[model samples]
Target: MSFLQPIALLGIALAATPILIHLLNLMRHRRESWAAMMFLIKAKENSSRMSKIRRWLTLLFRTLAICALSILLSRPMASDESSLINFSNQKPEVLMLVIDRSSSMQKKFLGSSKTLLRRGLEEFEQFSKSWPESKLVVIETVFSETVILDEIETLFSREMEDFFGPTDSGGNLPFTINKGLNWLEDAEIGHVQILVISDQQESNWKIRENEQLIRNIKDKIDSKEGLWKLRFLKLESAEINNFSLVCKTYREETDKFHPTLLITGNQKNTQSLAVKINVNGKLSNLKCRFFPPSTTWTPAISLSDQPPKGWIKISLPEDSFSKDNDYFFTYGNQEMLKVGIACKDEHTRKFITAVCNLDPERIFLNETFSLKSKKLKENDLLMIQGFSSPEEDSQILKFIKAGGRVVNFPDFDGNNKPQTFQNWNAIESASKNDFFQISEWNRNQGIFANTANGRELALPYLKILQRKIPKEGETLAFYKDGESFFRRKTIGQGVVYSFSTLPNRDWSNLGEGFVLVPLLIRIFDESSESPALKLLECGESASLEYNELTPITGNPNQKPSVNAGIYKELGKFFAFNRKTSESQDEMLNQEEMKKTMSSNHILWSEARANSLSFERAEIWNLFLIIMLLFLLGEGLLGLPAANFSFGAKRQ
Candidate 1:
């Protein structure tokens, strides 16, 4: 038993007050030895013992009443299954079950072979059986669709198996619950008991991001306080040792293709594991080690140039979750990178062309055309100085969506009215004898990142004499004055990188080629290689523009949007992997749950990985009834003895 208001239990001390008052009454009286009193005392002596028994009974009832009142105020709850059965005498009209069926639910329970989703389903099945009269309604996370089961036995039918099966997608608890609430209002459900079963993964809940939705749910539940009851069954266990693998980036060389992999885990000590590498049907193994205190490991694999266009599959030994253990990748035919220049300034165009032709063997300067030309789609990377009209903006945006990278510099002609992307503000000139210097940049994983051998770039030493500020985007590098030096925005499968200053001596020291060469070369390589191979999150394949997608690995019948594997569409292969957010280990704690729910009347319980049955039901009403009965008994026992005497004189 648990008390919602445990502090009220302190009132139980008031029960002793009845005994204290009775003793005080006895002390107030003194024995009188008068002869007239002796006769009356002797006449009542035979019935005095019976009167003493009645007085004690009345005191007992008063003490019980006080104790019952204290317990009632405390709001005691019964947690066992049997106790729940007796407490829920008044059954609900509807039993609504909300289940979280994300990939994390497939994790095994501690010390048990069954997964959290399996345990939750068994518990809900038993609960539905307990309330046979109530209609059963289920809301699953994958689709957030409500399924009404007319017969409780149909829950285990073959038709329902697919609905409860595992999914590769992540769960959205707030959205699913909101959908359930809307259904309740639309169906006009009365007297509902909502049971939410989940592992309470924090990423799935997104409590902070969905505050307004939670508030709306609280308001609707508050309006139907008596008609609705909310219960949460949290399935949780200690963090298990697990590893996740992903393909961060890959580079193509003359003789081989190198694929860079990132491995992350929760182990506290150094460990080594073998990874299986499959290159176009040929399998091989490689070993990698992870050091303590650092949970990330990056390993690169080299494949010969024999098969220019094929696929690669990297797999790790199964750990806690098998879904994230394997990563898929595909490569396409190699070709020279095409660079497009769209600038009105002669110096800027020559400078960019010089940079692109530095490695003439691998780079090709296709053309210097206007932004409105259809040839924009023919190049892999576009260097644009300004947008002259909305048509140019639409053409550039279309190029970006079709997997073309763009680098935008301030307009020398001062025409900056781009409709799709961020536009540049007026150019700002530096003060005399001072220049703008870069202070911070994201060097972890962007074009400004460290060199291949892990050497930092010379961005801190670069200075700018004049610059323009981008309106808005993700700022990758910041200037000393807190202005954006470099910003990036993602569109479709491609990216646009905006630089505040030009690459000439008049603008800044970027003409020295220290930062300009590597930055432009990296963007060029990324644009040339990234489009040939694509890595997407699960459930995102449905948005592909291809008319048909055929599975290349895993179950051939499973749709690419519902599973992780390699699929071919329009002669190109795309790899689908689980969302990185599912690998997070954080969960909702008790304090967070209380603050988000904001209702003390709700009942919640936690179930261990092995232990099965758990439920909470408020028994405060039972205590209230007991208290009333005790008070009634006390009143009857406190009445005078003459009230029970017969009316003999009237007869």
Candidate 2:
């Protein structure tokens, strides 16, 4: 048996008090000699044994009463085996179901046909039957909205299908739980049972990064000791052989279209796989070999003489997880990428202009302009090298909100006045005879990612003599001394990149054009009109303010936020896919889970795919009844017994 308040068990020491008092009373009796007293004592000797028996029984009952009271106060819980008889009495007044409908939950166990999500729903449906009077409320991951159900049967009805249906989005377990707690606090429900059904994927939990959130949740649960109970129905599978595909980026040439794909799986050996390609409804297949530990693959598709604006679908062989097996992408005709340069230093401006104009085909429309001019909205990307005035800062912000990317270089004029967009610390330079070298970066993604053919960038070869540090943002690349080389901040829909060093001979060798050219080109491509709208993570498309969106692929009636598909709004096409984190194979182990949810009020249990039994129940009422019964027995034994004669009555 477990306890909600184990400190109350210290009261069990009171049980020995009764026995100690009985021993003291016996020792207090002194021997007395008298003719009359001796005769009376002899007459009652036969009944002395029976009186002694009743006295001992009274003491035993008193001790048991104290023991039961202690156990009752501790709030003991019984396991399934012991709680079978008391299951009906364990109904809670409020039942809040926090379900994780992330993409990973769609995976099925090895050799099992039912998905983890389906198993969770079935388990909850069966358990809710035992609490027929509970007020059911659900919080799903996709929307994280508090849904009040009229009855438990409504959970399975067609009207509530959207809440329980599959979703390609990743789950925010902490945020969803917080939302449920907020609703419960507003409703002022006393007795609540929060049942969280999830696969315990680490990406969904994010235990380390969300320390503050977890602390707040723990404090809230601790404040309401007996009023709330938290339980987890973890549906964990043993096998980890799932294959996931991700479309990192796509390129279009004269007669061929290349789509860069990332394939990640848990298998440890090399294997051959077949990928199905669907280009505007025409189906074909390609054979590829997968090597363990290597996850990059680039495939080229032959394009016909059709219009460049179309959609492509890539599908892998069905594996343990079906949701991540397919990837959707939409392509469009290439347009000239416009770039605006606002640099105070002549050398910095010339270097950047040269790199932007390196493409011989004139794919880039590079223009030198001042930030004071109100022509920022037309450009796809803006490169600023120095501080700007208040008016220019406001215009830059508005441009960023309208989906314009910006790259900020350090100010060489020592003008450190605060700007509205971002703040930077004083410039720091390397010591004499020493230089700062790039030590680490995210090579799998972002501007400095590997080439389409899986070649690393030349960031490590660069040496930095001077740098500036941003006050706040995510560090994309780090120097040898743990300083940030590149930082990124996402403002609205656009991103701002901050480079610590300038692309000049004085600051670093970034002007060598190997790293600078590709970096600028990737950033320029990302700022295009179609790339951002063409591919998006699930749940992001729902936030768009588009008035009308027609389905181009998948179910026409389904919401884009809940499923992966392609849609068209106005004249632009958008493709929604599951978040890449959902494809990760890391799961929370038992130790980590215990550390994350460390509270007496919370209880977690592992569940098999087909198990339907409730694992735990609070049996404090059983101890309460036991304590009352023991007290009643003690009272009865303390009462005086009536004297009786077997043969004759004394008159």
Q: In terms of TM-score, which candidate is strongest? A: 2
Q: Candidate 1 residues 448-561, lDDT tens each?
A: 766544568899888788888886566878888778898887787677888898877788888788898888887776666555355566633232333247888887665554
Worst 10 residues of 1 by lDDT: 539-548
Highest lDDT against the true fold, candidate: 2
lDDT for model 1 comes to 0.75
Per-model CA lDDT versus the true structure: 0.75, 0.77
CA error at residue 256 for candidate 2, angstroms: 2.6
List pairs with backbone clashes in candidate 1. none
